[model samples]
Target: MSETTAEKIPVTVLTGYLGAGKTTLLNRILSENHGKKYAVIVNEFGEIGIDNDLIIGADEEVFEMNNGCICCTVRGDLVRILDGLMKRKGKFDAIIVETTGLADPAPVAQTFFVDEDVQNNARLDAVVTVADAKWLSDRLKDAPEAKNQIAFADVIVLNKTDLVTPPELAEVEGRIRAINPYAKLHRTQRCQVALSDVLERGAFDLDRILELEPEFLAADEHDHDHEHCHDENCTHEHHHHDHDHHHDHDHGHGHGMKHYHDEDMQSLSLHSDKPLDPNKFMPWLQQLVATEGQKILRSKGILAFSGDDDRYVFQGVHMMLEGDHQRAWKEGEPRQSRLVFIGRELPEQTIRDGFERCIAA
Candidate 1:
C-alpha cells in the first residue's frame, strides 16, 4: 500500500524536565474516560507505575554529542517495539512515548521521519511538553534539554500553576513565548488540560497548517530586508523584489514579554508569492536537511508548485522530511508558499535565499 493509503498510527511524545509532573499527566491520560486505547512507552516502570495494560519499559539509552546535547539512542528499540505492537493491531488506537526528563525530543521526533518502518506505520501527532510552572523559568535558563523541549513542543501544558502567584505565572509564560511563540499554552494544576488539546493535533500534517495559522497564506505586508546567502557553495544572487507576502515573528504575546536571548534557539519564517519548481526545490531541500539537520528542531512548509493547482505540504524534524500534495487551490485563493523554521540559530539568510532560488522563473 502507498503511504497515502497506509494506516499511519499517531504517536505523541510526552516530555518535561525532572519533577515536572510528566508521570502525573501520564496517569491522568491513562485513567481518563476517553475510550481510545493507547500503548504507553516509558523510561521505566515508575515507583508507582501507570495502570495500563500495554505499558512498555524503554532502555533509557541516551547519546551525548560534542555540543552537550543528550539525545535518545533508542531508535532500534523503538523500531522493534513498534513492530511488535503492529502485530497486535486493533488492540490500541494510539501510542505515547514518555521520555526521560533529560531526553532530547529531536531524536524521538526524528524517528517518525527518518525510519522507513516507523514512517510507514506511524505519524507523529505532537510533541507535548508538560512544564513545571514554578520551575520552568529556571529550567529554561539552566538546562539545554529543557529549552529544547520547549522549542520543539506543539502543545505546552504549564503544570503546577497553583504553586506560583499570578505575577510569577505571567513571567514564566513570557519566557516560554520568548523561546517558542508558536506552541499552544495551557495552564493546569496537575496536568489537567483537555485531551482534545493534546491528542490528534496534526502538528506535522501540512493539510492542517491553515487551521493552526489562519493567516498562513496571506501576502507579505511588512517591510524588512529578506537578503539571504551564507553557503560557500551558494552561487544564487540575492535580489530585492517586493512580493505579496508577510513573515510573522510575533505570536500575539503582547508588551512586557521578556526578551530571551538564547543564541542557540529561535524561530524564523520565509514567504514567497512565486510558485516553486519541484526540480529546483527538492534537491535544495534535501541538501539543506542533510547538512543542517542537527540544528533544525522543527521545519514545515506549504508550497504552490509551478504549473500545478495542487498545494505541496511538507514538514520535518532534523533530517527527516515528509510531504505530499494536498487538495487543489480553492477558487480565488492565492497561490503562494509559506515556510516556518523553529530551531537553534538557523541560517536565516541562507535558507531565505535558497528558497528564493527555487522560485519558478
Candidate 2:
C-alpha cells in the first residue's frame, strides 16, 4: 500500500480596487532583488507589461499577455495559460494572477477547483486583497464586488497606511473583523508588505468556514432547495469531505447585509478507486475549463495515474495551471485519487461524467 498522490500548490491572486497600487505592488515584487523567478498574468497585461518594461528589462518568463480579462473574458482559459507556463515551470518559482479591481473573487476562486488541467498541475497559495486604507472603508460598504473580494481573501493588505491616521486604520480593521474575522491583516504603506506574509497563507480554515457557512455544510446532509444542484452522490458539505483539513484562515472582510450571499459557493468531490490516463484526462479538463470555467471558479486535487510511482498534485484558477509530482507514495498507505470542484452553480453529474470518461480501465 502507498499514500495517495496529492500536493497543495501555492498561487497568489493580487486584487484591489482601481488605483489601489496593485500593479505597483506587482512591479515591486517582480523587481525584488530576490533570486526567485515568478510568472505573472494580468488582464490588459500588455498595457501593464509596458509599465514593467519601464521598470525592468524584457523577460518572457514574466508573461503579461491577455487571452482576455480573467474575470469574464478568459474565465476558463486560465488553465490553458497555466499549462503553457508549466512547459517551462523550472524557469519560475511561483505564479501571481493580478485581477481587475472591479472583478468578483468567486469566479476567480472557482477556477482553482473545477479545471482538470489545473487540478493536475498547481495548488492555490492564497488570495491577497490590497485595499486602500482610506477608500476601502467606503468601498466595502457600497461595492458588492469589494465585499466578495474581501470574503475570499486569505490575506488583506490595508495599503496606503501612511495616508491614514492610526484611528482610521483601527476603524477599518474593526469593519474587516466583522465580515471575515479570520483573515490575517497587514498594514502597509503603498502595498510594500513582505511577500512571505502574503503568499501561501492558506488562511481559510475549515472551522471558520463551518462557522460562517454551516448552512452549506448542512445542505449536503439534508436535501434543501439550492440554486445549483450537484450529483446525488455529491454533497457540498466541507467537514464531511475527505479533502477537508485544518488550514489557516484567509479572505478579506467588511461588507454589510447586501454583501452576504443567500447561497455560498458549491463544492463537489470526485473520488476514484482506480487510476486515470493522462491523455484522456487533459482534453476533458481543457474542455471543462473552456466551457464552464467561469462557473467553475477553482478546482484542485491529487491524482493517481496508472503505471506511475509518483502521484500528481495539481491546482487551477480559471485557466492557470500549477502542478507537480509532490512526492512518491509512502509505504502501506492507500493510493486513492480524489478531486474537489467548487463553483457558483455547478452541475454535479456533468462533472462526474467528464471525470468518469477519463478513467483508465
- TM-score for each model: 0.82, 0.51
Q: Compute the lDDT for candidate 1.
A: 0.74
Model 2, 1-361: lDDT tens digits are: 2332644345688888887788878877787777877777777555453333222222122222255635433245566667777676566777788788887665555556555567566766678888888988798767867766665566778789888876677566655533443345688897888887876555332222323222222232211112112333333233222111111111112211112221434456677767888888878877887777766655666778888777677655555445677667668755656676555566767888888888898
Give the least accurate 10-residue stretch of model 1, judged by summed lDDT: 238-247
Residue 323's C-alpha lDDT in candidate 1?
A: 87
TM-score of the candidate numbered 2?
Answer: 0.51
lDDT, residue 359, model 1: 93
lDDT of each: 0.74, 0.60
Q: Write the per-residue lDDT of candidate 1 for residues 1-361, one digit (tens) a residue.
A: 3555747889999999999998888888888889999998888686335566689988755443334323323366777788888888789999999998988887777666556788788888899999999999899888999999998998889999999987688678757755665677788998888999889998877779766653222221212111122222221211111110111132322323334445667766676777999999999988887777777887888889898889888887776678888889899997878776778878878897898899999
